[model samples]
Target: MNSLSAPQPVPLAQAHRLLNHGPTVLVSSAHGKRRNIMAASWSMPLDFDPPKVAVVLDKATLTRELVDASGEFVLAVPCRAIAEQTLAAGSLSGRDGDKFAALEFETFPASRVAAPLPAGCIAWLECRVIDEPQVQHTYDLFLGEVLAAWADPAEFSDGRWHFSAEGRRSIHYVAGGQFFSTGEAFEVSVTG
Candidate 1:
Protein backbone atom coordinates (compact mmCIF):
# COMPACT_ATOMS: atom_id res chain seq x y z
CA MET A 1 0.00 0.00 0.00
CA ASN A 2 1.01 3.63 -0.55
CA SER A 3 0.96 5.21 2.86
CA LEU A 4 3.41 6.87 5.21
CA SER A 5 2.44 4.21 7.73
CA ALA A 6 0.38 1.03 7.73
CA PRO A 7 -3.31 1.55 6.85
CA GLN A 8 -6.45 0.46 8.60
CA PRO A 9 -9.21 -1.80 7.24
CA VAL A 10 -12.60 -0.28 6.40
CA PRO A 11 -16.02 -1.67 5.56
CA LEU A 12 -16.77 -1.86 1.86
CA ALA A 13 -20.17 -0.16 2.17
CA GLN A 14 -18.59 3.08 3.32
CA ALA A 15 -16.30 3.20 0.30
CA HIS A 16 -18.47 5.86 -1.30
CA ARG A 17 -17.30 8.39 1.27
CA LEU A 18 -13.94 8.67 -0.45
CA LEU A 19 -15.52 10.14 -3.56
CA ASN A 20 -18.34 11.96 -1.80
CA HIS A 21 -16.52 15.27 -1.97
CA GLY A 22 -15.59 14.68 -5.63
CA PRO A 23 -11.93 14.19 -6.47
CA THR A 24 -10.20 13.82 -9.77
CA VAL A 25 -9.34 10.15 -10.41
CA LEU A 26 -6.97 8.10 -12.50
CA VAL A 27 -8.94 5.75 -14.72
CA SER A 28 -6.99 2.58 -15.62
CA SER A 29 -7.82 0.19 -18.47
CA ALA A 30 -6.26 -2.79 -20.16
CA HIS A 31 -7.30 -4.90 -23.18
CA GLY A 32 -4.96 -7.60 -24.43
CA LYS A 33 -1.60 -6.00 -25.18
CA ARG A 34 -2.86 -2.44 -24.91
CA ARG A 35 -3.23 -0.68 -21.57
CA ASN A 36 -3.78 2.95 -20.74
CA ILE A 37 -4.26 5.33 -17.85
CA MET A 38 -5.90 8.73 -17.87
CA ALA A 39 -7.14 11.41 -15.55
CA ALA A 40 -10.87 12.05 -15.10
CA SER A 41 -12.66 14.53 -12.86
CA TRP A 42 -16.20 13.78 -13.99
CA SER A 43 -16.90 10.71 -11.92
CA MET A 44 -19.52 9.99 -9.24
CA PRO A 45 -21.34 7.22 -7.44
CA LEU A 46 -24.61 6.18 -9.06
CA ASP A 47 -25.84 3.61 -6.53
CA PHE A 48 -24.92 1.70 -3.38
CA ASP A 49 -25.50 -2.06 -3.23
CA PRO A 50 -23.40 -3.78 -5.86
CA PRO A 51 -22.05 -0.28 -6.16
CA LYS A 52 -22.30 1.45 -9.51
CA VAL A 53 -20.30 4.41 -10.78
CA ALA A 54 -20.54 6.85 -13.67
CA VAL A 55 -17.59 8.53 -15.32
CA VAL A 56 -17.40 10.97 -18.20
CA LEU A 57 -14.66 10.16 -20.67
CA ASP A 58 -14.19 11.90 -23.94
CA LYS A 59 -14.56 9.64 -26.98
CA ALA A 60 -11.16 10.69 -28.22
CA THR A 61 -9.10 9.55 -25.27
CA LEU A 62 -7.13 6.33 -25.51
CA THR A 63 -8.57 5.41 -22.13
CA ARG A 64 -12.12 5.69 -23.53
CA GLU A 65 -11.28 3.80 -26.71
CA LEU A 66 -9.65 0.92 -24.82
CA VAL A 67 -12.40 0.85 -22.20
CA ASP A 68 -15.02 0.73 -24.93
CA ALA A 69 -13.23 -2.17 -26.57
CA SER A 70 -12.55 -4.14 -23.38
CA GLY A 71 -15.53 -3.22 -21.15
CA GLU A 72 -13.40 -2.93 -17.99
CA PHE A 73 -11.48 -0.28 -16.11
CA VAL A 74 -10.29 0.71 -12.64
CA LEU A 75 -10.99 4.06 -10.98
CA ALA A 76 -8.10 4.93 -8.70
CA VAL A 77 -8.39 7.94 -6.39
CA PRO A 78 -5.18 9.98 -6.65
CA CYS A 79 -3.95 12.17 -3.82
CA ARG A 80 -2.37 15.62 -3.57
CA ALA A 81 1.06 14.00 -3.93
CA ILE A 82 0.27 13.14 -7.56
CA ALA A 83 -1.65 16.30 -8.47
CA GLU A 84 0.94 17.44 -10.99
CA GLN A 85 1.07 14.04 -12.66
CA THR A 86 -2.74 13.91 -12.70
CA LEU A 87 -2.88 17.18 -14.59
CA ALA A 88 -0.20 15.96 -16.97
CA ALA A 89 -2.17 12.79 -17.75
CA GLY A 90 -5.26 14.86 -18.55
CA SER A 91 -3.26 17.15 -20.80
CA LEU A 92 -1.31 14.50 -22.71
CA SER A 93 -2.43 11.70 -24.97
CA GLY A 94 -2.01 8.00 -24.23
CA ARG A 95 -1.98 7.33 -27.98
CA ASP A 96 1.62 8.40 -28.39
CA GLY A 97 2.92 6.14 -25.61
CA ASP A 98 2.14 4.75 -22.20
CA LYS A 99 1.10 7.61 -19.95
CA PHE A 100 1.80 5.62 -16.80
CA ALA A 101 5.34 4.88 -17.94
CA ALA A 102 5.84 8.47 -19.04
CA LEU A 103 4.63 9.72 -15.71
CA GLU A 104 6.61 7.09 -13.77
CA PHE A 105 3.61 5.89 -11.75
CA GLU A 106 3.77 2.51 -10.07
CA THR A 107 0.88 0.08 -10.27
CA PHE A 108 -0.37 -3.17 -8.79
CA PRO A 109 -2.81 -5.78 -10.11
CA ALA A 110 -6.49 -5.23 -9.39
CA SER A 111 -8.47 -8.21 -8.09
CA ARG A 112 -11.34 -8.21 -10.61
CA VAL A 113 -10.10 -6.16 -13.55
CA ALA A 114 -7.13 -6.44 -15.86
CA ALA A 115 -6.15 -2.83 -15.29
CA PRO A 116 -3.59 -2.14 -12.63
CA LEU A 117 -4.38 0.29 -9.84
CA PRO A 118 -2.08 3.29 -9.81
CA ALA A 119 0.06 3.58 -6.68
CA GLY A 120 -0.25 6.44 -4.18
CA CYS A 121 -4.01 6.42 -4.69
CA ILE A 122 -6.00 6.46 -1.47
CA ALA A 123 -8.61 4.06 -2.90
CA TRP A 124 -9.22 1.76 -5.85
CA LEU A 125 -12.49 0.71 -7.44
CA GLU A 126 -12.40 -2.03 -10.05
CA CYS A 127 -15.37 -1.85 -12.40
CA ARG A 128 -16.76 -3.67 -15.42
CA VAL A 129 -18.75 -1.72 -17.97
CA ILE A 130 -22.51 -1.98 -17.99
CA ASP A 131 -22.80 -1.10 -21.62
CA GLU A 132 -25.01 1.77 -22.77
CA PRO A 133 -24.10 2.72 -26.31
CA GLN A 134 -26.27 5.79 -26.37
CA VAL A 135 -24.66 7.21 -23.28
CA GLN A 136 -21.19 6.36 -24.48
CA HIS A 137 -21.67 8.06 -27.81
CA THR A 138 -23.82 10.91 -26.63
CA TYR A 139 -22.22 12.04 -23.41
CA ASP A 140 -18.96 10.09 -23.27
CA LEU A 141 -20.33 8.68 -20.03
CA PHE A 142 -19.40 5.16 -19.00
CA LEU A 143 -21.29 3.42 -16.26
CA GLY A 144 -19.95 0.36 -14.49
CA GLU A 145 -20.54 -2.06 -11.66
CA VAL A 146 -17.84 -1.87 -9.04
CA LEU A 147 -16.54 -5.41 -8.87
CA ALA A 148 -14.09 -4.72 -6.02
CA ALA A 149 -12.72 -1.86 -3.96
CA TRP A 150 -9.81 -1.09 -1.56
CA ALA A 151 -8.36 1.82 0.37
CA ASP A 152 -5.46 2.98 2.46
CA PRO A 153 -6.57 2.73 6.06
CA ALA A 154 -4.52 5.71 7.17
CA GLU A 155 -6.61 8.06 5.06
CA PHE A 156 -9.90 6.14 4.92
CA SER A 157 -11.67 3.77 7.27
CA ASP A 158 -15.21 2.94 8.44
CA GLY A 159 -16.49 4.64 5.25
CA ARG A 160 -15.22 7.96 6.51
CA TRP A 161 -12.02 9.82 5.56
CA HIS A 162 -9.53 11.24 7.99
CA PHE A 163 -6.68 13.06 6.38
CA SER A 164 -3.75 13.39 8.76
CA ALA A 165 -1.68 15.48 6.39
CA GLU A 166 -2.41 17.78 3.47
CA GLY A 167 -0.38 15.72 0.97
CA ARG A 168 -2.19 12.47 1.73
CA ARG A 169 -5.72 13.76 1.13
CA SER A 170 -7.64 13.39 -2.14
CA ILE A 171 -7.49 16.12 -4.76
CA HIS A 172 -10.26 17.85 -6.72
CA TYR A 173 -9.56 19.38 -10.07
CA VAL A 174 -10.84 22.81 -11.00
CA ALA A 175 -9.59 23.82 -14.46
CA GLY A 176 -6.18 23.94 -16.04
CA GLY A 177 -3.62 23.23 -13.34
CA GLN A 178 -5.71 24.41 -10.36
CA PHE A 179 -7.07 22.00 -7.75
CA PHE A 180 -8.61 21.91 -4.28
CA SER A 181 -7.58 19.49 -1.59
CA THR A 182 -10.40 17.46 -0.14
CA GLY A 183 -11.35 19.95 2.58
CA GLU A 184 -12.13 19.38 6.23
CA ALA A 185 -15.24 17.38 7.03
CA PHE A 186 -18.19 18.40 9.18
CA GLU A 187 -21.43 16.57 9.82
CA VAL A 188 -25.05 17.70 9.66
CA SER A 189 -27.76 15.73 11.37
CA VAL A 190 -31.21 16.12 9.82
CA THR A 191 -34.38 16.75 11.84
CA GLY A 192 -37.75 15.56 10.78
Candidate 2:
Protein backbone atom coordinates (compact mmCIF):
# COMPACT_ATOMS: atom_id res chain seq x y z
CA MET A 1 0.00 0.00 0.00
CA ASN A 2 1.46 3.33 -1.01
CA SER A 3 1.17 6.25 1.45
CA LEU A 4 1.38 9.97 0.93
CA SER A 5 3.08 10.56 4.29
CA ALA A 6 6.84 10.43 3.98
CA PRO A 7 8.52 7.53 5.74
CA GLN A 8 11.05 8.33 8.42
CA PRO A 9 12.83 6.44 11.16
CA VAL A 10 10.62 5.77 14.21
CA PRO A 11 12.79 6.97 17.05
CA LEU A 12 12.19 5.36 20.41
CA ALA A 13 11.41 8.77 21.89
CA GLN A 14 8.77 9.55 19.30
CA ALA A 15 6.82 6.36 19.93
CA HIS A 16 4.29 8.31 21.97
CA ARG A 17 3.27 10.15 18.81
CA LEU A 18 1.48 7.00 17.72
CA LEU A 19 -1.19 7.51 20.39
CA ASN A 20 -0.87 11.25 20.83
CA HIS A 21 -4.13 12.02 19.03
CA GLY A 22 -5.93 10.02 21.72
CA PRO A 23 -7.63 7.31 19.71
CA THR A 24 -9.69 4.74 21.55
CA VAL A 25 -7.70 1.61 22.47
CA LEU A 26 -8.49 -1.93 23.49
CA VAL A 27 -7.11 -2.96 26.87
CA SER A 28 -6.40 -6.69 27.04
CA SER A 29 -5.44 -8.63 30.15
CA ALA A 30 -5.68 -12.03 31.83
CA HIS A 31 -6.07 -13.30 35.37
CA GLY A 32 -5.90 -16.93 36.35
CA LYS A 33 -8.07 -18.83 33.84
CA ARG A 34 -9.85 -15.75 32.57
CA ARG A 35 -8.96 -13.08 30.05
CA ASN A 36 -10.75 -9.92 29.03
CA ILE A 37 -10.88 -7.11 26.49
CA MET A 38 -12.37 -3.64 26.82
CA ALA A 39 -12.32 -0.29 25.04
CA ALA A 40 -10.95 2.93 26.50
CA SER A 41 -10.64 6.40 25.05
CA TRP A 42 -9.25 8.08 28.12
CA SER A 43 -5.63 7.18 27.58
CA MET A 44 -2.57 9.37 27.10
CA PRO A 45 1.22 9.41 27.18
CA LEU A 46 2.87 10.52 30.39
CA ASP A 47 6.61 10.40 29.67
CA PHE A 48 9.00 9.99 26.74
CA ASP A 49 11.99 8.20 28.19
CA PRO A 50 11.18 4.67 29.20
CA PRO A 51 7.79 5.46 27.59
CA LYS A 52 4.92 5.63 30.04
CA VAL A 53 1.14 5.72 29.59
CA ALA A 54 -1.96 6.46 31.64
CA VAL A 55 -5.46 5.13 31.07
CA VAL A 56 -8.73 5.35 32.92
CA LEU A 57 -10.45 2.04 33.53
CA ASP A 58 -13.64 2.13 35.53
CA LYS A 59 -13.36 0.21 38.77
CA ALA A 60 -16.56 -1.68 38.10
CA THR A 61 -15.28 -2.87 34.74
CA LEU A 62 -14.16 -6.46 34.36
CA THR A 63 -11.08 -5.11 32.63
CA ARG A 64 -10.08 -3.17 35.74
CA GLU A 65 -10.47 -6.25 37.91
CA LEU A 66 -8.25 -8.34 35.63
CA VAL A 67 -5.64 -5.66 35.09
CA ASP A 68 -5.45 -5.01 38.81
CA ALA A 69 -4.96 -8.65 39.60
CA SER A 70 -2.49 -9.32 36.78
CA GLY A 71 -0.53 -6.07 36.71
CA GLU A 72 -0.24 -6.22 32.91
CA PHE A 73 -2.32 -5.33 29.87
CA VAL A 74 -2.04 -4.80 26.13
CA LEU A 75 -3.28 -1.68 24.38
CA ALA A 76 -4.43 -2.31 20.81
CA VAL A 77 -5.36 0.57 18.52
CA PRO A 78 -8.10 -0.55 16.17
CA CYS A 79 -9.01 0.79 12.74
CA ARG A 80 -12.38 1.94 11.38
CA ALA A 81 -13.42 -1.54 10.31
CA ILE A 82 -13.41 -2.86 13.91
CA ALA A 83 -15.20 0.09 15.42
CA GLU A 84 -18.35 -1.91 16.15
CA GLN A 85 -16.40 -4.64 17.90
CA THR A 86 -14.59 -2.00 19.88
CA LEU A 87 -17.90 -0.55 20.99
CA ALA A 88 -19.24 -3.97 21.89
CA ALA A 89 -16.15 -4.66 23.97
CA GLY A 90 -16.89 -1.64 26.10
CA SER A 91 -20.61 -2.37 26.39
CA LEU A 92 -20.23 -6.00 27.44
CA SER A 93 -18.62 -7.56 30.49
CA GLY A 94 -15.86 -10.14 30.44
CA ARG A 95 -17.18 -11.75 33.63
CA ASP A 96 -19.41 -13.90 31.42
CA GLY A 97 -16.58 -15.74 29.62
CA ASP A 98 -13.83 -15.20 27.10
CA LYS A 99 -15.21 -11.96 25.69
CA PHE A 100 -13.11 -12.31 22.58
CA ALA A 101 -14.60 -15.67 21.76
CA ALA A 102 -18.08 -14.44 22.53
CA LEU A 103 -17.53 -11.53 20.19
CA GLU A 104 -15.87 -13.76 17.58
CA PHE A 105 -12.77 -11.62 17.86
CA GLU A 106 -9.34 -12.75 16.69
CA THR A 107 -5.98 -12.06 18.30
CA PHE A 108 -2.23 -12.15 17.70
CA PRO A 109 0.69 -12.70 20.05
CA ALA A 110 2.61 -9.89 21.65
CA SER A 111 6.37 -9.81 22.17
CA ARG A 112 6.29 -8.55 25.77
CA VAL A 113 3.08 -9.50 27.57
CA ALA A 114 0.77 -12.46 27.84
CA ALA A 115 -2.27 -10.52 26.70
CA PRO A 116 -2.95 -11.24 23.04
CA LEU A 117 -3.16 -8.32 20.66
CA PRO A 118 -6.52 -7.92 18.93
CA ALA A 119 -6.73 -8.75 15.23
CA GLY A 120 -7.39 -6.04 12.61
CA CYS A 121 -5.90 -3.42 14.88
CA ILE A 122 -3.78 -0.74 13.27
CA ALA A 123 -1.23 -0.71 16.08
CA TRP A 124 -0.34 -2.59 19.26
CA LEU A 125 1.45 -1.60 22.45
CA GLU A 126 2.51 -4.14 25.04
CA CYS A 127 2.47 -2.50 28.47
CA ARG A 128 3.50 -3.34 32.03
CA VAL A 129 2.19 -1.48 35.04
CA ILE A 130 4.21 1.25 36.75
CA ASP A 131 3.60 3.81 39.62
CA GLU A 132 0.46 5.54 41.01
CA PRO A 133 -1.14 2.74 42.92
CA GLN A 134 -3.08 5.36 44.80
CA VAL A 135 -4.57 6.62 41.59
CA GLN A 136 -5.49 3.16 40.35
CA HIS A 137 -7.26 2.26 43.55
CA THR A 138 -8.79 5.72 43.80
CA TYR A 139 -9.72 6.78 40.28
CA ASP A 140 -9.58 3.51 38.41
CA LEU A 141 -6.54 4.86 36.59
CA PHE A 142 -3.55 2.71 35.68
CA LEU A 143 -0.05 3.68 34.63
CA GLY A 144 2.06 1.55 32.36
CA GLU A 145 5.41 1.36 30.63
CA VAL A 146 5.46 0.59 26.93
CA LEU A 147 7.56 -2.52 26.58
CA ALA A 148 6.95 -3.15 22.91
CA ALA A 149 4.98 -1.65 20.04
CA TRP A 150 4.13 -2.80 16.50
CA ALA A 151 2.05 -1.30 13.73
CA ASP A 152 0.44 -2.60 10.56
CA PRO A 153 2.99 -1.88 7.83
CA ALA A 154 0.13 -0.89 5.55
CA GLU A 155 -0.91 2.04 7.74
CA PHE A 156 2.19 2.79 9.70
CA SER A 157 5.96 2.63 9.27
CA ASP A 158 8.98 4.57 10.39
CA GLY A 159 7.71 7.29 12.82
CA ARG A 160 4.64 8.42 10.91
CA TRP A 161 1.24 6.93 10.02
CA HIS A 162 -0.28 6.86 6.56
CA PHE A 163 -3.96 6.05 6.28
CA SER A 164 -4.59 4.80 2.76
CA ALA A 165 -8.36 4.29 2.94
CA GLU A 166 -11.35 5.11 5.14
CA GLY A 167 -11.39 1.63 6.64
CA ARG A 168 -7.66 1.71 7.34
CA ARG A 169 -7.50 5.01 9.20
CA SER A 170 -7.27 5.03 12.98
CA ILE A 171 -10.62 5.51 14.78
CA HIS A 172 -11.47 7.91 17.56
CA TYR A 173 -14.46 7.06 19.73
CA VAL A 174 -17.13 9.68 20.34
CA ALA A 175 -20.01 7.82 21.94
CA GLY A 176 -21.88 4.59 21.37
CA GLY A 177 -20.82 3.26 17.93
CA GLN A 178 -19.93 6.77 16.78
CA PHE A 179 -16.33 7.50 15.85
CA PHE A 180 -14.21 9.94 13.89
CA SER A 181 -11.28 9.10 11.68
CA THR A 182 -7.92 10.67 12.48
CA GLY A 183 -8.66 12.83 9.45
CA GLU A 184 -6.34 14.68 7.02
CA ALA A 185 -3.16 16.35 8.15
CA PHE A 186 -2.57 20.06 8.25
CA GLU A 187 0.47 21.85 9.60
CA VAL A 188 1.14 25.41 10.69
CA SER A 189 4.56 26.99 10.73
CA VAL A 190 5.57 29.05 13.75
CA THR A 191 7.57 32.18 13.18
CA GLY A 192 9.53 33.56 16.08
Number of the predicted model whose lDDT against the real structure is largest: 1
User: What C-alpha RMSD separates each model from the true structure?
Assistant: 1.7, 3.6
Q: What is each predicted model's overall lDDT from 0 to 1?
A: 0.85, 0.81
Query: What tens-digit string does per-residue lDDT give for candidate 1 at 1-192?
Result: 455654333355765665777889999999988888888999998888768899998988899888988899999889998898888888889999988899888888888899988888888888999999998999999999888888887788767788878998899888869999888878999899
Q: After superposition, how far is residue 178 of candidate 1 from its true place, in Å?
A: 0.4
Error of 2 at 85 (Å): 0.5
Off by over 4 Å in 1: 5-11
Clashing pairs in 1: 8-153
Q: Write the per-residue lDDT of candidate 2 for residues 126-158, one digit (tens) a residue.
A: 889986788888888899998887777667776
- Evaluate candidate 2 by giving its C-alpha RMSD to the native, one decimal: 3.6
Tell me each candidate's TM-score: 0.93, 0.90
- Least accurate 10 contiguous residues by lDDT in model 1: 1-10
